[model samples]
Target: MWSFSTYKDKRYWILLITAIIILVLFAVFTPDYILEKTNFVPFSMLIFIVLFWSTYHLWKYFGDKKKRNNTDDSCDL
Candidate 1:
């Protein structure tokens, strides 16, 4: 059975995608004043946190996947 946690799950993907889109849109579409008026510093911080979380989960996900593959390979030996 597979269990979902704060990391390496749908939540992680959603946050990662959402943050990327937001950053892209912010840089391309939104104007500088909009961010300044809306408090871009805090918003950027939040996005960075999400990015960090996504990075952590991505590493963990790949690491666990590698471990599982190795174990499976060993079982075939």
Candidate 2:
């Protein structure tokens, strides 16, 4: 199981680095697939959208949990 603390600290940076690596790899390895390919999905766009959606959910999940914990702590105090 993953811990919230680990995610809160590293999710954005990790996702960003992974996105950059994948994009660089795709650009170098698959230039033909990416150039003016309106009929098909662009590699960078696909990776970017996936990263954006994943990060949004991760942030929402952690933020909601943190808020709940804070509320609980305040009530206990």
Candidate 3:
């Protein structure tokens, strides 16, 4: 059976905490530098990570769509 387990999903919370910590650290210690280096390091990495995940999901979604379309076409024939 499928289920949601907090212990098994702890990484989600850990990632959230890590993101918060990184933001706080950047804000406190390197705000200007972060803003300046927005194209290179931490900020860019965050953006790239999000975009990469989004692209993966977009690819998966389109794959599902194509599969559904093929199934429907075959059924119609």
Candidate 4:
């Protein structure tokens, strides 16, 4: 399972970004046959990671909006 703490760290982001750049460079420079027989697992994993990250940010935005609304309502009462 993925942990949010690791993702929240700046160091982790740097590492993840570095890896992604490397992967992209490798894919671009390498021959197509290098990953021709590769399984679908890595692609599935990449998609899953993207979805999870987006979902987390979306929920965070909603949660912050709700908190602000609640505070405003209470202040007006």
lDDT per residue, candidate 4, 1-71, as tens digits? 66777567564576567657866776778676656757754884587578656755666678779989999
User: Model-by-model lDDT, in order?
Assistant: 0.75, 0.72, 0.64, 0.68
- For candidate 1, write residues 1-77 as lDDT tens digits: 44666545665676678777877876788777777776776877787887777776777789789989999999884
lDDT of 2 by residue, 1-77 (tens): 55576556566666767777977886677768556588555665876788776786678798889999999899873
Candidate with best lDDT: 1
In Å, residue 63's CA in model 1 sits off its true spot by 0.4
> Clash number for every model?
0, 0, 0, 0
Say which candidate scores most in TM-score. 1
Q: What C-alpha lDDT, on a 0 to 100 scale, does residue 39 get in candidate 1?
A: 72
The runs of at least 3 residues in candidate 2 whose Cα sits more than 4 Å from the true structure, single-residue gaps closed, are 1-41
lDDT of candidate 1 at residue 67, scale 0 to 100: 89
Question: Model 4 compared with the native: what TM-score?
Answer: 0.49
Q: How accurate is candidate 3 locally (lDDT)?
A: 0.64
lDDT of 2 at 30: 72
Candidate 4 local lDDT, residue 32: 67
lDDT at position 71, candidate 4: 92
CA-only RMSD, every prediction? 9.0, 8.0, 9.3, 10.4
lDDT of candidate 4 at residue 18, scale 0 to 100 = 66
TM-score of 3: 0.48
In Å, residue 57's CA in model 3 sits off its true spot by 0.4
Worst 10 residues of 4 by lDDT: 6-15
